[model samples]
Target chain A: DVKVTQSSRYLVKRTGEKVFLECVQDMDHENMFWYRQDPGLGLRLIYFSYDVKMKEKGDIPEGYSVSREKKERFSLILESASTNQTSMYLCASSLGGKGEQYFGPGTRLTVT
Target chain B: AQSVTQPDIHITVSEGASLELRCNYSYGATPYLFWYVQSPGQGLQLLLKYFSGDTLVQGIKGFEAEFKRSQSSFNLRKPSVHWSDAAEYFCAVWSGSSASKIIFGSGTRLSIRP
Candidate 1:
């Protein structure tokens, strides 16, 4: 079975602190994505990477960035954490087709 | 340009009762639809997807969804509700282009009464 793992299941950070959320996928999927989910608004895409070292901005890219150094790993970076950024962050990987996505157990971030 | 809508915010049903969740989408061309279930504090799991071909698609956990092009609706249904099935369900659709981005609906919360 394909598996996606997140570095942390729950995290608490102070305001203005820099944060990193890691995601690793065993499957060699060509595409990786980072999304933030909130009540009522649903999951909004923050960023996505289609290939190694290549990234694209999604709808809600403010205060968030991504890095894909290896095909199996993608990282989401928050330059400066804020209270408004507290939410469930999800990572997903998919092949470059009309294929289903495999998601990692989300990381719930709480900013104080 | 593509979007998805899950009309129901919350639904409650007794065990052994039937279930249905509505999903509506708007896209210019043919749309690829998907249903996903998320347990508390967990990632979303793919329940079913419809790309083309047959409209009725069966999924794991005794779940199924029907795609109606005329109504732009893909509704999920199950013959009997289980207590373990209580979770948040999301409907999503793919916007076909070079980017091929997927957009998710607001989601519907399901509650099963024992």
Candidate 2:
């Protein structure tokens, strides 16, 4: 089975603090994505990496950035955490095809 | 711009009752649609997908979906929903003639009441 693992299942950060969420996929997929899910708002894309060192902003990339230094791992960074940035962050990876994506367990970030 | 919509925000059904979740899309060309389920505090799982070919497609976990081009909709259905089937269902669309980015619906929360 394809497996995607996230660094933390839950995290708490103070305002203006930097936060990092890491994700690793064992399937060697070409595409990885970061999304923040909120009640009623659903899963909104934050950023996506198609290849190493390549990143693209998604619908809600304002307070977030992403890193793809290696093929197996992707990182999401919140330059300065804010109260509004708290949400359940999800990481997903998929092959080049238009097939289904495999997602990690998710990191619930709480900004205080 | 391509987009997806799930009309219902939440649905309640008794265990062993039939279930159907509505999804609609707006895209210039034929779109690739998918249904995903997410249990509480877990990542989403793919339930079914509609790319081309047959309109009715069977998927994992006793779930199925039908794609209707005329209505631009892909609705998921289950003959008998179990209690474990309670989860959030999201519908996504990608209009990739060659390549495409996915756009997801707000999602429908399924509540199975016994």
Candidate 3:
């Protein structure tokens, strides 16, 4: 089975603090994505990486950045956490084709 | 721009009752479509996907979906819903030239009643 694991299932951070969310996929997929899910708003893409050291901005990339130093891992960074950034963060990975994506359990972050 | 719409925000159905969740999409071409289910606090799981060929597709957990080109809809249906089926369902589409991104619908939350 394809497994995507996130660093933390839940986290609490103070305002202005930097937060890092890690994700690792064992399937060796070439594409990885970071999305923040909010009530009513649904899941909005934050960033995505197509290849190692290559990344692209998604619909809502203003307050978040991503890193893909290696093929198996992707990290999402919140430069300075804020109350508005509190949400469930999800990481997904897929083969770069007509393949379905596999998602991590998710990291629920609370910025207070 | 490409987008997905799930008309219903939530739906309630009794155990063993039939269930249907509506989903519509606006895309320039025939889009890659998918139906995913997410239990509370968990990641989304692929229930079914429709790319081409037969319009009707069977998925895991006894769920199925049909693609209607004329209606621009890909609605999910189940002959009988179980209590474990209570979860959020999201309809997603891939319109990008590459499989780099997918636009997901707001999602429909399913509630099961005894």
Which candidate ranks first by lDDT, i.e. highest? 3
Note the residue pairs that clash in candidate 1.
none
Q: Let me know the DockQ for model 2.
A: 0.60
- Cα lDDT computed for each candidate against the true fold: 0.93, 0.91, 0.94
Which of 1 and 3 is the better model by lDDT? 3
- Summing lDDT over every window of 10 consecutive residues in candidate 3 chain B, give the lowest-scoring window: B94-103
Order of all candidates by TM-score, from best down to worst? 3, 1, 2
lDDT of 3 at B44: 98
Q: Give lDDT tens digits, candidate 2, residues B1-114.
A: 788899999999999999999999998887788999999999999998988899999999999999999999899999999999999999999746222357899999999999
Candidate 2 lDDT score at position B7: 93
| lDDT digits (tens) for residues A55-88 of candidate 3 | 9998899988899999999999999999999999
What digit string (tens of lDDT, one per residue) describes model 1 on residues B45-102?
A: 9999999999999999999999999999999999999999999999999867444468
Chain B vs. true chain B: TM-score per candidate:
0.96, 0.95, 0.97
* DockQ agreement of candidate 3 with the native complex: 0.72
How do the residues B17-48 of candidate 3 rate in per-residue lDDT, one tens digit apiece? 99999999999888899999999999999999
Candidate 1 lDDT over residue span A1-97, tens digit each:
7899999999999999999999999988888999999998899999999899999999999999899999999999999999999999999988877
User: Lowest-lDDT window of 10 residues in candidate 1 chain A?
Assistant: A93-102
